[model samples]
Target: MTSFRQSDRLRNVRYDVRGPILTEAMRLEAEGHDVLRLNLGNMHPFGLEARPEIVDAVAAGLAPAQAYSDSRGIPEAREAVAEHYRRCGIDDVSADDVFLGNGVSELITLTLQALVNPGDEILVPAPDYPTWTGAVNLTGGVPVHYLADEANGWNPSIEDIESKVTPRTRALVMINPNNPTGAVYSEETVRGIADIARRHDLILLSDEIYEELVFGDARHHHAARTAGDDVLCLTFGGLSKAYRVCGYRAGWVVATGPLHRAADLLEGVTLLSNMRVCPNVSGQYAIPVALGAGAPGSPLPADIVDPDGSLERRLALTADALNAIPGVTCVPPRGALYCFPRIDREMFGVADDEAFVLDLLHTEHILVTHGTGFNWPEPDHFRIVCLPDEHVLTRAVASIGDYLARRRR
Candidate 1:
């Protein structure tokens, strides 16, 4: 008998948040242990409700969704996506240029498979959404970690990006209103990255899923719009985060700039999209309504904004609670439902972030992802999802504070 083995692609793919810790957390919860799940960015359990209009739209389209739609996506959804980008100042994008998938997660894999060749390199931010690194690795591409300067509000450092680019570097991945860090890229930073991509003739992959979730005065600058004709850009967005519709799995990518330069790449992407035979049809049906309802100047149903909206309240609670913790300094998240706080190792007497996170989990029943999970080299940080309720987050932070105090003692 021959022994079987997993592929090398699975080697670097440990999901620290949902891998072992979450399994234990789930088991503990099953056995009725009081575990505060601050790990994943899931919102459903936190009272974030889907818009009723979106629900109605999905229900109304059930008949059509029962049949297969276009491989790229239903025409209406694609059009709505194009319009959504147009509203963001991205010009000349048509529905034909949009490709929909199960989620931004699915579309990212497809894009990487289409664009990346074996051993090719792509620039990704340290402390990024781990999926980007995983996708690059799975596609047989090397992911180069570029710094998003913590000193600079976690914005991608243009100088660092330029230094990392090599002859084999094919693209740069930018997660605006970045996951974990929740730092919204400023217009200057966006333009700087766009300029770098243009200079090096690299594809720009902008993940803007949290575009609509910006907190007071913080703006999400669309990198694709900033790049213009100089560089080929693909902006990926979805209804998951902002709309509280992660289960819908509706996501789309828009190809902006000169199509001729990326004709082969787009052709490959289209082939991948066709291979999937379209995203969930019911989810596709809801895209137009989701985009339209959420669009500025469009009449959003009252309930969508009623009771102060779960996300707004959640952000406030998280910001307030995280700020109160000793040796845990977090930048007020400008967007997204996360806060990545830097842990003062000296103050806490913690050896590394993974150890700190594990200690917190075991001692406080609070789960979190260490900075290393986001590909950060140092282990003095961790990310906590702000989706939990005010009381829960407050208690969780308090527990962390207690843990830190004990470590110091």
Candidate 2:
């Protein structure tokens, strides 16, 4: 028998969010251990259910979904996506500019496969969601990590980004209400990144998946809107995080900025979209309903999680609990469903974060992703999903605190 090897394209590919630690967690659960998985933004597993409207919409469309639709998506869902972007302040967008896929995950992959040839350079933020890194590598592109200013509310350092830019750089990827960090980009930050893309003639790929999940006064300024009609920009959004509809796998990407410049990339996207036939039909049904219900003027709250307590309340409670632990300092995330907390490395005698995460799983039955998992160039940080309720977060953080205290002793 021959030993099989992975494709050469996979040499740099990684999806650490569900990497080795999660595999071990599953093994433990199979052996009857109760594992509290704080690894990813999977709200359903943590008491939050999908919105009732989304459920109904998908069920209603199941019959019609039996047949193939357009490669892009159904007309109504695409129209809804166009309008959603128009409302977000992006101009000149129409249904024709929208492309739907199984998820932002798939759409991003399609875009990368189209945009990057071997050795093409793309700038990705450090501590990225990992999807960007994985896709870039799979597409044979080189992903250059630009460090975000951790002390400056996790904002991407414009100087760092510009310094890293080279003639070979093809694009810049930005994740607002960032995964892991949950730091909402300020308007200045958004415009600054847009300015970089515009000046450098680089395509901007903005992942705004958590656009509606902003907490308190922190706002999510759509990056494409800030880039205007000058730079070639692509904005992505979906019903996963905010709607708690991860399983639906419904996501859309809109090409914005100068239409002429994006013609080639758009053509590439069309080819890939055609290859896939179309995105999931039942999932497309939820797009119109989800976007329509999220209209700006609506007075009703849209959160499907924590009906008893508001999203703001839950977010605040979770951040407070995590910060209360000794040697654990977390920036109160202004948005998104996670909080990446920094631990005192010396105090815990921790060097390898992945090993530390495994130890925590065995000792406390709690599972979390190491910072390195998200490409955070360090071993002292870890991300926790705040989807779990306040009580659960409190308990989880306490367990971490206890574990650290014992290590210090």
Candidate 3:
């Protein structure tokens, strides 16, 4: 019998957040060991529950969900997404400019599919969520990684991004409040990136999924607002991170700025959206109530996780704990539920981060993602999800410290 093989297109696609190391962690758990999973930023396992309003609203709309919604999404959900962005300062958006999907994951693939042709270049940040890289490759485009300088608070180096642009470059993907590195882009940084996009005539793809999860003084500018009025920008965000409803698969993409120029691209996106028939209908039902919370001055449940008041207490404590380990220094994440810490390779004499991660898992029973897994060129860093409880984070990092000490021997 012949074994089934994956397509050649999947060769460059990688999502190491749940890749090999996670598979090993699962194997250990099945053998009956209690593994502390810090590999993924999943909220529910850490005690977050779906809010009452979101649940009730979806339940109330369950009847209509039996039928397919409009290909772009039911009008109510699209309007809610549009209104959310409008409040964020992207005033040009309307229901027609918004497209709903199961999650930002689907929208990202669709957006890339519509825009990229074979060999087209897409400038993306280093140390990014692998999905962005995977999407570009799957769409037959090349992902050109531009360094996001760690020394500069993990902000994208404008010089690096600009230097990589070629005539074939079609777009720039910005993951604000970045995944592996939680550095939120300051206002100046956001504008600088937008200026590059405008000068090069590149479509701006902004992933703002973690926009609502900022910590400390880390400022995040809405990419749509910062991209200027003449640039075409698609900003993607969803209920996964903000509302702690990753399982609900409710997410959206909003077109903004001078998007009218890309009439053909937007139509391509719509046709693809229709190819899927519609996103999860049940997921579509929860949008209005979830987003109905009034404008800027009005408080919404999303604000609870913002820095200083909500998860700040845990984030602050976790950052301190990780940095306390000798030769392990982590920039306290300004936003998002992750800590990407640099490991002094000379201190441990381990050159492969993936091996280091697996050794830590086997010895400490704590799972983490390696930096190379997120496409870091060096083996000097690893990503740890900070979504666990205060005590869990404490124990997990302490285990890592002990494991590091052993590696030093």
Candidate 4:
């Protein structure tokens, strides 16, 4: 008898956010152990939910959404995306430039499938969202990592990115208010990356899914705007993070900057989109309402989450707590919903981060993703989501500190 195996394309692919650690966590749950999941940035599980108006819009469109929409997206939703970007200062966008999908995750896979051939290289940030690296591998493309300098608040090192470019490099990926690390790229950093892409003549793949989730003085700079009318850019945005609608799976990728040159690639994306028929239709209905002229000042559930300060307060508490630990230091997250904290490998006796996290699961009953799982080349860090309330977050971090103290002893 022959063993059934997954396709060769899946050989190098790994989405560790839901991989083995999650499996073990599930096993523990089956044994009736209560687990604190600080790993995923999923909002609803932590009592963060979509705005009522957005939910109402989805419900109202359910009847019309029973049928499949145009492969690209519902016209209103596509136009809403285009208009949203136009207001963001990418003035040339129109509905024709937008391609909607079932969240930015799907768009990432689709864009890579259309762009990469075997052996092509794509510049992905070290400590990326992981899905980007996995999707590139699934497409048989080589993912070249450029360091996001932790010494400089985890901004992408422009020099490192420049040194990694080669003739085979096809595209450059930028994640603002980045996941895992939660460092929003500065305007200079964003433009420097766009300049490198321009010089190399590479397509720019900007993931702005957390665009609206910035904290403090942090502001998101659109890569497409920086890529300008010269470099071809695919700007990916979605309702998942900012709108607390992860389950809706609504996202859009806007093509800008010399679109006339990339007609062939866009055609491939359209072909792939058609193969999937369409994204969730009812979710599409929320887009126009979420981004249209009359959209709420802020899409977050302020009423439920302490009048807009809840996320900021939680992230601040988590970072502060982590920094207070003896052998740990967390670069305060300026945006997004996580804190990527670095631990002293020597002090903690940590050789393998995965093993360290597994031990944490067993001893502390808390689940956080190891840094290496996000494709960081080091075993000294781990990411914890900051969506939990103040009390829960403080307790979880305290548990982590207690666990680390034991490791030192």
Clash counts per candidate, in order, are 0, 0, 0, 0
Q: Candidate 4: worst 10 consecutive residues by lDDT?
A: 298-307
Write candidate 2's Cα lDDT for 90-186 as tens digits.
8678999999999999999999999999899999999998999999999889999999777998998999999999999999999998998989999
Per-residue lDDT of 1-409 in model 3, one digit per residue for the tens? Answer: 9999999999999998888898999999999999998888777888776667788878887898999999999898898888888777778688999999999999999999999999999998888888999999998899999998888889888888999999999999999988989889999988998999999999899999999888666667997898768888899988888677888889999888776698899999999999999999998877777776443454554554542364676777777998999999888888888889999999999789999999988998899999998888999999988877788878888888988898888
Sorting all predicted structures by lDDT, with the top scorer first, yields: 4, 2, 3, 1
Q: Write model 1 residue lDDT over 172-262, tens digit each, in one string.
A: 9999989989899889999999999999999999999888888777877888888887688999999887777888899999998888888
Tell me the TM-score of each prediction against the true structure.
0.95, 0.96, 0.96, 0.97
Evaluated with lDDT, which candidate comes out highest?
4
Task: Report the C-alpha lDDT of model 4 over 1-409, residue by residue, as the tens digit.
Answer: 9999899989778888898999999999999999999888888998898768789999999999999999999999998898888888999899999999999999999999999999999999999999999999999999999989899999999999999999999999989979888899889999999999999999999998888888788878989887789999999998888788899999999999998999999999999999999999999999887775445565432233234688988999999999999999999998889999999999999999999999999999999999999999999999999998899889999999999999999
Question: Candidate 4: misplaced stretches above 4 Å?
Answer: 294-307
Q: lDDT scores for all predictions?
A: 0.85, 0.87, 0.87, 0.91
Query: Could you give the candidate ranking by TM-score, starting with the highest?
Result: 4, 3, 2, 1
Q: What TM-score number comes out for model 3?
A: 0.96
Q: Which regions in candidate 1 have their CA more than 4 angstroms from the true location?
A: 293-297, 300-310
Q: In model 3, which regions exceed 4 Å deviation?
A: 293-298, 306-310
